[model samples]
Target chain A: MIRRLSQARERGIPEATVARLPLYLRALNGMAERGLATVSSEDLAVAAGVNSAKLRKDLSHLGSYGTRGVGYDVEYLIYQISRELGLTQDWAVAIVGVGNLGRALANYGGFVSRGFRVAALLDADPEVVGDHIAGLSVEHIDELEAVIRRRGVSIVVLATPAAAAQQVADRVIAAGVTSILNFAPVVLAVPEGVDIRKVDLSIELQILAFHEQRKTDRMTGGPAMAEEWPEAVDL
Target chain B: MIRRLSQARERGIPEATVARLPLYLRALNGMAERGLATVSSEDLAVAAGVNSAKLRKDLSHLGSYGTRGVGYDVEYLIYQISRELGLTQDWAVAIVGVGNLGRALANYGGFVSRGFRVAALLDADPEVVGDHIAGLSVEHIDELEAVIRRRGVSIVVLATPAAAAQQVADRVIAAGVTSILNFAPVVLAVPEGVDIRKVDLSIELQILAFHEQRKTDRMTGGPAMAEEWPEAVDL
Candidate 1:
């Protein structure tokens, strides 16, 4: 992981680590808001739903910001983490698909307060291109590359359908964008240096289904122990 | 963590383990499809994007399924994980909120292949309540409890708006449902023994932004070494 971090530093932070930093930041902020001046590794770990050892090791890669005996100053740690995560600077972002999900993202307070700024909204349908959404006029998909380059966008949000996701990703990458947050279900293959993160709602539900099943299994008994008659299987 | 796992097992498998089981299954299935009969811990770990030791440890909880020298049989491991995850049993799931995202979930193919079966579609809006969605009629929210009971639904997917999620959750829980997969951004404070797992798309993006920021900082040679500029003070 450390090697991945160093490589990310030389090129960029590994997409995985980049994804987790906000979770840690949120936990630290919660501690700070609670009037806790300092927090032990264990305290932050629990709040972030991660292990303390891993937290300490992750923090170590950035720099020795925590006191050995006193733990970490919550405010200072927040600033450090924020700085490391580039929260100190604003990032211009473009949304490729101006669908319901895209509109929700635009109106979402979390993205606005954080480092990301939704610079433009684009869609393939010409009828919806000039439509006003979240106070911004939606642009045609033809303007994607131009708008991305003009705005100096480094991050692109792909909310398009599965069929259009790869095409949008290709255009976004061709426009010099390095990081992409994909909501499409398909597995995206990007260049070696580019970073792509997927957020699939169906996949998350399926994962939960797997766990909910286990819960039912344990309630009945072991896997081999069947209590009632099995219903017809569907697939 | 182990203690939490034990406690979770009392209810079912730990939510953490549940989340990873699909990932493991996906990797194992990939191996099987590739015509590989067996995979070592290291090989499986790489495919699953997890550490080899952690993979071995997680598998150990199931049983000593892997040989010390020969590793694990791909098809056998897939079956074991599937059974442990309750994928062997079909779970009837009701999606409450047939909006753009919910409609997408209802149509997704992943759920059918996995343990989940989208048995019902629901909406609070009168106009949409009777509309057809993915071959299922969108039932009114008033019929939620009846549908859940009739279907013997052990799992409920909350794709409702953030404002309505809690109310829906209350109704679902009152109907004896114990597991919830929440897509809304708000946190659901469930009663003990009830499992709630959240998947927030915006949160994932914020996390990615944080790390993307850090990468840019390192490449620019840290704040201290960067050239002094008037805008630096603002950051």
Candidate 2:
């Protein structure tokens, strides 16, 4: 696995391609479950919702070129992609902020299915610190560094409120975590070499609203609603 | 607002620019709170995590050209971007599934602050239905169509399981929702006219793990761990 990953690093797969590998992996897993032996790039592309050309190009980064006529072998492709994504070994993950989102994430089956274990949960609230969620007792935030060290947590998920996110991020990074999945709304400033991925729910809705407004404006032959501040700006 | 939007539509902001507008808006909101009436491009870009050049280019899409030395009026920029994103009008959003994720979405305060109202919550399970979450009663899935129409829901959020996502999507689309924010781990097949954005938590973790693995491999000067199937493949 390490050899393949070293090769992957030497080849340097595009970040966009890295992001899509899980999608392809998910599609391939479904195919394997259905008793399929092989899959054409076209079928897999459709399953993953990408164009066939793009899918083939992405797979090429992993040094796997499917046989032209017979297509790609399903099991082999799953194994290859899984190895490339480092999913062959389970990763111990810790989530900070035991709010609704944190609890939801702990209970989410998707992470466990993909070789990720929710090893620890931490929150600052005294009332919430001892609560049991997803069969694990929530530990107080003060034990964050100890919990991470004791449980061998590698990646930390930040679902804390905006005010607490940065402080929690600082403490975790200082504890030697390099990878973070942030669900807080703030843009965290991390030191060099740390990987931070943010998931903001409101941002998604705002993007949808932009397109939805365009559709409504088209139907109405102009802006769908008048501005709250018509005289607010002259632009 | 209508005139500005019509002009904005004519200018046709890049989708990338539209996506980043919210970031700029959030940064500006923080500045506004801090009593910063105006901001230079460089400072604003730093806050929004983008370069000054890119920030200027994105703002240019809205026909905004900051003063050469003084920069932009923060309040005016906020209004313009909000209007462009259609956040000027409150959007009634209904969430389907009412699972842990669904409940999280319902209780999230960020949406309300950004002109999105969680007008209704619907779930298929009788046990979950009728429960109050975030001050709104969880309506039965049978009332999905009715609640959407009655509440004037223009956008739908799907937090359903992978199995039920498509069915709920089809129903909501048929009920006249043109926008959807899907958190399910499935590739939803929606019509071209509809806009669907997916947020897969597991995918994010997998991406982080890929990088985390790479970082570990680099530290170890090779693959961190040996392959489970050394003899499985010759490649």
Candidate 3:
């Protein structure tokens, strides 16, 4: 994992920049769909909801591709960001635990629109097994290693309950899947060389609540830490 | 939104720091659950998976709360972070799109533990409407404005299809939801003072794939942009 990171560092693209690349890519894709051939940094920034100068700085790190006045060629820029983000290659993904979240993930359009293919879905529940979702049949957890090996799934998505996350993570790691996107609300412990990214709805909501509190604080003009909830938002 | 932001600034907490407060809170909560008392910056940083120096800087923004020699009181730190994150007061949330994703969000335990109450669930589909999920009966989309008004739901979770996301966002915004956590694959346009945060699973997967590609590049010592697959991950 360190070696992999060093390679990104060697190219001088900060992880922050790498993360935002997808956001920009999405915005650019939208413009392309609208029949726009080129867009200025400012316009792209507005679409991507980022500062133009910051966007310029980020793109500069990738190499000077934007023009002085013509801005950036939309299709060419799309290829550049997609290539940089490794979307040019198809990646086989296995989603473990065919629960609500897993089912939603399977049906998500963004994955297919990009290069990610949900190759397999696995669940422990006998009731959920043998179910067809998004054109793929849900397999039992007993078929995990076999399915992973057979399907050549390099990435795993864990949508299991918190109690089962760690065990499933361990098993998937042993099955040779190196990357995992976790949604189980648990702190997963993976050995060296594994890459895990967590998307916790609770954490996201808490962050929003912090801002919501700030909104209330401004409205009441009281103490910043006041215990009162702001009145109904009429705005 | 600008007013609320200014209020947050008045309290001297940077938005970037505010974004990370939940991470520290999560790490601290995990430790508290394990019955830890005092934790050094390095220990806490490791648990939070952030740079220790950066972590110290972030905490310093909060004040001289963490004692240098003895580290920080785990419970106190949790309280500080929680209060800073506005988790002390319960915020009611209504989720639109009672699809698979909505069901998963309703079942998630982290929300309640972090002081977010899923007050209502709404959906537009005739089939999904009236179905019981995660103990809440899915309400028709017609009740959206009324429910938001009646239930005092401050946050809206958009899990609708891409085609319906923008329309749902418009209605919710009109109904007075200022904070939105969007799970749909579309970028929502909100009026000023309203906050919108998007979570795109496809983008996350693409990011992991970038690192995975880098890992493979290191192993092969070949060009980073190999046009062919490594062939182990079939399908």
Winner by DockQ: 2
CAPRI rating of model 3 = acceptable
Clashing pairs in 3: A152-B234, B1-B193
Regions of model 2 farther than 4 Å from truth = A1-9, A221-235, B1-9, B221-235
Q: Which digits, one per residue and each the tens of the lDDT, describe model 1 over residues B1-235? A: 1223443233444556656666788778777888999999999888776789988877767766788889999988888887776677767778898876687667655445666677788899998988876677899999998787777777789888877998999999988888898887655757777888777776766766665655555576542211221121110
* lDDT for each residue of candidate 3 in B14-120, tens digit (9 for 90 to 100): 77788788888878888999999999999998877789998998887766677768999999988878877878887788999877678878876665676777889
DockQ of every predicted complex: 0.17, 0.32, 0.31
* Quality of model 1 by C-alpha lDDT: 0.73
Candidate 2: tens digits of C-alpha lDDT, residues B1-235: 2234446445677989988999999999999999998999999999999999999989877874477789999999999889889988878778898888888777777645667777788899999988988877888998888777766788899988899999999999998888999999999999989999989999999999999889888887443332221221111
How many clashes (backbone N, Cα, C below 3 Å) per candidate? Answer: 1, 2, 2
Using lDDT as the measure, which candidate wins? 2
What tens-digit string does per-residue lDDT give for candidate 1 at A1-235?
1223454243544555655667788777777878999999998887777789988878776667788898988998899778777778777888888766677667665556666678899999887889997789999999887787677677889888777998888878776666899987656767766778877665576676565655666686532222332232343
Q: What is candidate 3's lDDT per residue for A1-235, written digit by digit as tens? A: 1123333334757888888899899899889999999999999988887899999989877777788968999998999889887788777788998877788778766545667777888999999999988888888999998877776677899989888999999999998888999988777878999999988887788878878888877876432221233333554
Q: Summing lDDT over every window of 10 consecutive residues in candidate 3 chain A, give the lowest-scoring window.
A: A222-231
Q: Model 1 Cα displacement at B211 (Å)?
A: 2.2
C-alpha lDDT values of all predictions: 0.73, 0.84, 0.81
